[model samples]
Target chain A: MNRSAFPPLNLRWLMPLLLALPLLVQAADPLPSWNDGPSKKAIESFVSAVTSEGSKDFVQPAERIAVFDNDGTLWSEQPMYFQVLFAFAEVKRLAPQHPEWKEQQPFKAVLEGDQKTLAASGMDGIIKIVGATHTGLSNEAFIDNAEAWLAKAVHPKSQKPFTEMVYQPMLELLAYLRANGFKTYIVSGGDVTFMRAFAEEVYGIPPEQVIGTTFVTQFQNQDGKLSILRTPKLAHNDDGPGKPESIDSIIGRRPIFAFGNSDGDLQMLQWTAAGSGKRFTGLVHHTDAKREWAYDRESKVGKLDKALDQAKAEGWTVVDMAAEWRQVFPFATATSGQ
Target chain B: MNRSAFPPLNLRWLMPLLLALPLLVQAADPLPSWNDGPSKKAIESFVSAVTSEGSKDFVQPAERIAVFDNDGTLWSEQPMYFQVLFAFAEVKRLAPQHPEWKEQQPFKAVLEGDQKTLAASGMDGIIKIVGATHTGLSNEAFIDNAEAWLAKAVHPKSQKPFTEMVYQPMLELLAYLRANGFKTYIVSGGDVTFMRAFAEEVYGIPPEQVIGTTFVTQFQNQDGKLSILRTPKLAHNDDGPGKPESIDSIIGRRPIFAFGNSDGDLQMLQWTAAGSGKRFTGLVHHTDAKREWAYDRESKVGKLDKALDQAKAEGWTVVDMAAEWRQVFPFATATSGQ
Candidate 1:
């Protein structure tokens, strides 16, 4: 039965060979990239707690919901949120058609390669850029443009394509969680539609499970045909305290586990930890400067001041990427998917 | 390996076992309650198409979304929509507060037990009843009222509690699809938050995944405290074409599977069918007058005219309640959670 591996005769790694054979191939050290440390142990313990049956830690099948913050947590969020970069690229691509964009503030920054002005735009400028590039399009057009832009866009930091910047350990964790019956959701502050464009191929999270920022969309009668219009109105933010509210509004049930990267995700961890029983919260602190950029407390991209203090106070697990992960990026590097 | 049961050339199902000890539980038969026939084969083929690895029929993990219309499809929408009954009861409950409602259109019909007046009131009366019974109260207060009323009230026909009336086989199907990596959403024409109150406890479908008709919601600054308000502005109507629009806008992916009982569900079924590959669409025809009640085409509640036609023309599976399902309601009925 291969039950001898676990000690105390109570911890069984494999369920009884039930009716249908298991679907996944048990690989070499599943998530081999995750480093050796308490962070790993914390993840294993939480996963086991909710998965193992007939134990007090055993979560019911229905309550086995896990939420992940997408940016800086599951994938990379450096220099800027990837969506902003996509918007800039989108503006650049449309520059020929929109000649007046060169005279515009945010659009001018995008066109002139004036990275400073774009960065200086900060939150408001980013919103302006996103709204400008995102509007007046159909769902198909948006997906097509996003796919085209992402195929060629590289991260300013790693100098690798944007998709290559995803954390390898987190990728395995996603697969592992799905294997153990947890419905994982990317509850991020990023636009749900934008993330949905690639999440399926990247994280294996379906569009329906992604709860994030959104905009108003309308149905239009276009040339005697019905079409969907993506508008610029703010729908849901899915950040800070909004994270908890979004989880309540979108997921309905309190999850048994939550994961995040920075202070923006502090409230989400708080919400998950506050759940009734067998709760787990883990934070990914960017600390691998060699393989990937590392920063904490004072980083502009994924600031961690509030969440750092809260995690330490509450005894939440803080994953140090440099020491805790053997590999930072997936083996599918810049050219792998190609 | 005991692989003789499956064709040797078709090793997709067995390969996982050799590669990894897949959890091999008999793929949960979602339609176990239904006797084997075209209905069962149709369900199996749909699951096979979407779940089998690498098949063009292979729906991506992100696209593995299924939606169900709640009233007639997930449960029972008969005699009248459940919400309609709730409005009638609400008139009686608030009778002590608003005795004037006794002279109102729908309220008067409900109070006087006059079906003629209720029909005459029609759109105007229905809107008045919905607005009156649904708004201006705290979400918690409304849910509490629903719970109390649900506990005490009985259906006009069969004298059974409304909670006892949900279809049991559909519940199994919901659990089954979820087991096979499908995200199940209750896309109903009912109130989103209202149905959300009991949906989790009743259907195991969480509120976030419940797409339904919605009203305008506002965050109000109430004397230095922030409280949310739900207004009757008719935000999203999740019926007919509204179902597909809501699915695309909220979920961002067309569903691979859809189910419903009436013409109200025809558009949703069409939406699912229009998705690329390995799709499943079903119509739940209430054909059992013995176990439940058979009414379609001309039935006042949950008429199945268009859907029945579409089911035939488009080769969609139709669930004849009388012949297919072994049971119609959850084993435990009334008194406690459905």
Candidate 2:
């Protein structure tokens, strides 16, 4: 009689609870900042499929390489690219040294806050400005100047430090992937050294993992001390087609995951998707006008035109920022604009 | 209570044993392949000092960067560089495709097995041979070819695979540094792509961590598939001054430790030593003619003149292969000749 009474106490209840315990703990949401949607689902599923042991889609930890475009994908890239803004500010800072800059077309446009003329100056004009402002300094000095500027530099719209404006969802994604054994790398169009100045602090990506446009540097032995001097000459233009080329040359392995925000990342995504095995590609579409600056085909900085089309055709996840993200910037308060 | 009665259990006997436990376990010879000598002492002491918490010489894990030259420093480069041998073999492999190579100066020299003529051709001639054989293939194809050749190719004298010819002491050193949280990188003059094919397997260094001379690669999209095609154009010559330049551009941080066996690594050593903290510089002096081929100033491959002199003047550790290393090649048996 006692056995019958105790047996009815139902071990069934504990069975389901025990079964759900592993799922609850093992599947803690890696990307909490991400709103529950297809983009987040795509990322989570891909990571799970690749990381699960004995699964056909399982990729070894060493082969789980992920590449991300730095500017709009990882952080805000408007009113213009942050590095370009730095160049403009540098133009103003160095204008006293060269009074001619006050009259120079691009430099004058930069000094006068003329966005239209600056855009009209084209890549050649931009290169000249970058050369004039970004070169001839030792790497240490350049890094110091960049770091100091970054420390104080605020976004034009957000009025928050640029580093603080990095997308919280993306940061979560980066950490999520890294925790899943993915080696995250920044394959950006920005200056490699400039990105290195803030990458580790802001993104938790070390300098060695930040691959970007490189300026020619010369090793100088001056008075028994050695220094690497940055030169104006562009060593590798890691943009568009250059992205895949640089990744192949530098990383040597084709990445299984790639994230980008513009046409400059088109080839990279293509290259990643073309790899033999499961691959994941994501495009951060800036559709959040109120929370963050929204621009696509018509916008100059971080233009998302061709890559947007390619993402649709290739079944790549297109992250509609306004909808997919519960929060935009890491520093955003309830009342603060994204 | 029974202090005198039990003779205090000889408590003092346990003191030295307990104190030595940590020293015995934690300080087990990390570099057993290295003999008990100044070179080993220098390496052990440098590692201990930098890794010791609260020590003035303590380097943060992130800052514990070490760069190693691949050719003579990690592996044997005598009887001509193994990569050069590979190039020569490639020239022969592709002779059918280029009938003109039969008559071309450098190509003809390589195809004809004319070492004297190839040597007489100087750097220019060698470049021609490398350009002819090491280019035109897609990166994947080139790496496949390189890996296939490495799989089958044996050293002319030792009959050992080139990878097996790597020094055991250096391998131990690499593992030791890695165990101490040091990031190891290969900053070599060898082709960056070539070294990458076997770097991970041979040295436990990843492709992204291998910095070397780069050949220009063009992104090719063929039938909706993306491939990076290696070109004959030399992009960056990562040797001598270029070593420091490439290290700065690629690694972004100055290495605290640098190891090399040639003048080509002079700037790298200088740059490492010139860093603002305690640094280690090691020169692998090829002094074991009987055990391994020895040629320094007079050798075309792995020249070790200027750097050797500089190492002595700068107090950099000079590792004599014969004396400092208990074993040279990793596969060496006790009775095996160098």
Candidate 3:
């Protein structure tokens, strides 16, 4: 039977042929926003090598753990970190509750809109602001306040909701890794509970997979009902060296892949690199002043100095946001689902 | 065109038919060791109600979280908690290295095997013992010691490895819940790291899903390599009210089902019960003295006083181990993985 003897098939045959044709074709690019560069190529190569069965780098599905640093890596952390801004707003919100806050240095600076004095106050001022707003409420109440704020809070420059400011390329990378049997986790310097509110919806990461700084919480039994109350004291810092420490304590596994932006994530990248296996480490270089903020070593928040230097020396992929990504935030496309 | 004529077919049809027939049959009973009682009935009914789509109690798969206490619930905790035993053994193991331990109060009691004096020392003494054995080493070192001890250590009464002391009915229940879309987590008063070593192999729950008491750890850079050294300091004590606090902090979602045995678990049960929609709470009564050690109100360890009262008053399923379980430990069955 010569195949050339047959003409084009009927509508029924054409329908089934059309339906099955795509399966035989090459799949669509998972990270479309990512420019065709060495950074994207490295990610693709790493994922393929690890996931292909019978290969030397084949990792079991359970062991395919990937951790990401939240602030500068997944979303923008510029002109000051978003959480610091939230803290300042919180100081204003709670100003009426404590009359003495009007006279307080950090509180007064925040209330007076004096960024210079607040910056001079340093981490001590930030901690005080965070503790004042984040603690002294039931866990549910704190979560409610955070959720309400996130619903309305917008980026100062972008004029987009804070959630919408997440990197589209990174979002695509998360989905791609997950599709290849990786469990993505957010190991952040931000509050664990605060990150949890939007992590699931924004990054497709569940709450249990998010590890971050924590405040001391007290269990309360009021009128025979149990509730957890967030306290003023800090529990775990989850920054710098605390990143790897929290990873070991909570995750109980060395992640094969780690992505970060700043020096705070340097230890996490080092830990991942130290693991005896096929590992991938990436640093997001915020070099996009036109599309996004671009302060590095001199920046107060998310300073990416040591990590950027180390990434080059260690052969870790350094994602130049301006050059490597076609788009920065997800709000560029209507179908991005920010 | 007659379907009846095609039934009297070839061996090819018969072979595929034989293979597919088992798929149509009803599934085997997942909880075969559980006796027919109100406790068993309640569990089955609750799981079925919540899992059935379009039902009033239907729950999403992501929300089907179940938490369980370790000691006295999953395994035996009589004669003293297994961890306390491990601490005592560790004290003896490290006695030669620290000759000063001979003169210390808790250390001397632990080294001398003086149960009476150790009991008098209370939680303070236990904490000291735990700190000495569990901390000061790297995370890997601590896990290795715990794993080594668990491998050789036998229950005094049962003369079996402590891992073999897990309740068979509860194991079946875990499998049942998981089969019905529930994710089981061990939220225990025991050490989190200690549980992770065996939880995956024995209980089928992964380390990431386990939440328990934590010890302070410091990040160390030894010869340019990073390591997290467990400190000789107590961190969060996940007991009684701390159970709920840890759950809120770590899991970040209220469990729909909670299983526990003692007063340490009361708050966890209360927290689970307090959640809206379908919820289940279970308590193992420790009523089987013949098969397993039994104790309740006045017992120093595995005390089940207030929780038992609450279980009765709040319609929580109280599992009478003696009457409700056909077998206690999984060792009885030849097919059991243990």
For residue B115, what is the lDDT in candidate 1? 86
DockQ of each: 0.21, 0.35, 0.37
- At residue A176, what lDDT does model 2 achieve? 89
What pairs collide in candidate 2? B291-B338
For model 2, the docking class works out as acceptable
Residue-by-residue lDDT tens digits, candidate 1, B113-182: 8989889878788888888888776554676778887788887776777777787878888887887888
Q: Give model 3's DockQ, 2 decimals.
A: 0.37
Error of 2 at B221 (Å): 0.5
* TM-score per candidate: 0.75, 0.92, 0.91
Model 2 chain B worst lDDT run, 10 consecutive residues: B2-11
- State what share of the real interface contacts each candidate retains: 0.28, 0.74, 0.58
Q: Write the per-residue lDDT of candidate 2 for residues A1-338, one digit (tens) a residue.
A: 34335322323445456557868967687787788889989998999899999999999998999999999999989877899889888888888999988787988999998988988998887888889878999999999989989999888887899899899999999998898899999999999989999999999999989999988889999888778899888899999999999898888889999999999999999999999899999999999888888899998788889989989987999998888888888777542212
- Runs off by more than 4 Å, candidate 3: A1-26, A96-100, A333-338, B1-27, B333-338
The C-alpha local distance difference test score for the whole of candidate 2 amounts to 0.88
Q: Write the per-residue lDDT of candidate 3 for residues A85-180, one digit (tens) a residue.
A: 888877888888888988888999999999899889998988888888999988888878888889988889888888988999999999999989
| Candidate 2 displacement at residue B192 in angstroms | 1.1
- Name the candidate, 1 or 2, with the larger TM-score value: 2
